[model samples]
Target: MILNNPSRKEIKNVLDHAKTIAVIGLSPNPSRTSYIVSESMQRAGYRIIPVNPRADTVLGEKSYASLSDIPEKVDIVNVFRRSEFLEGIADEFIKIDCPVFWTQLNVVDENVFNRLADVGYTVIMDRCIKVEHAILK
Candidate 1:
């Protein structure tokens, strides 16, 4: 089954209300695409929680090994991981009960999205959160 993302208005609402984002698979290296997008979003005034096991910190923010390790509430779980790893990430999302689930462009799995939606979580796959933010303006 194919997955359909929310409308632009819904995306805009998520962007407007979400203040803190837990970025899973975020890399410390500036050259990486994850780092670029995450950094751009951070600069746009969103508090970014870097979730990378291999890095102690990224973009001046302390990084956690996983979303389960984040101590505070996170508005969105932005994933930059490959499609094959999404099921595991989805499990973490289920545990955290985050309001929104987003994956970077060209990454998606309909089954994972269906599971998130089953739990009433807003799912956004194959979309760039940073681009959506810019468009909302």
Candidate 2:
């Protein structure tokens, strides 16, 4: 079956309870959307963990090569990758303690969404986390 995005109420609940967000495909470049969105979220009081293999650090936090490399529990896994790259990260997402898997605007895949939902993850696709936080919180 297909999975739908959590309700605004549910999204707010997740954002309210969440503290740390693991940003997959985050870039060190300030001009990138991931960096911009992540920075905005960081300023809004959520800890941002950059999960990029090419960068050692970003926005003052030590970057991990992958989600599995992060030493702490993650509240959210915010992805900034194309749909084709999503399958590669599914394993790490499931291995972590993240409750939410949020994809940035324009990034989406139905099969992946359904699979994550089947495994009990709250998945949000093609939405901006920063925008949601600003509107819903």
Candidate 3:
């Protein structure tokens, strides 16, 4: 069965209450969309955690090799990786206690969505978190 994302109101609620966002595949380069979006979010008051195995840091925050490496509480797991990499990310996500799993624009995986949703995780796919926050907040 196809999976649907939460409504605008639901998304707004998530953004409204979220304090920290863990960004998977976040790039250190300022030219990348991930960096730009994450920077915007960071400036907007939400703590941004960079989850990149190769980078040491991004947006002035320490970078973690994976989701499991983060030592703090993560309210949202925002993904910038391709759809093919989502399964691995989902695996790491489940190992953590993040409440929301968000895949960036054009990133979607039915299996990942189903798996996370089945386990009562709030999954938002193929949507830009920055845009949503800008419009909803």
Tens digit of per-residue lDDT, candidate 3, span 13-47: 99999999999999999999999999999999999
Q: Enumerate residue pairs that collide in model 2.
A: none
Q: Candidate 1 lDDT, tens digit per residue, 11-93? A: 99999999999999999999999999999999999999999999999999999998989999999999999999999999878
The alpha-carbon deviation from the true structure for residue 106 of candidate 3, after best TM-score superposition, in angstroms, is 0.9
Off by more than 4 A, model 3: none
Alpha carbon lDDT of each predicted model = 0.92, 0.91, 0.94
Using all chains and alpha carbons, the TM-scores for the candidates as numbered come to: 0.97, 0.96, 0.97
Where in model 2 is the C-alpha error above 4 Å?
1-3
Tell me which residue pairs clash in candidate 3. Answer: none
* lDDT score of residue 100 within candidate 1: 95
**Residue 121 displacement in candidate 3 (angstroms):** 0.5
Model 1 whole-model lDDT (C-alpha atoms)? 0.92
Task: Please give the lDDT score at residue 31 for candidate 3.
Answer: 100
lDDT of 3: 0.94
Q: Candidate 3: deviation at residue 14, Å?
A: 0.3
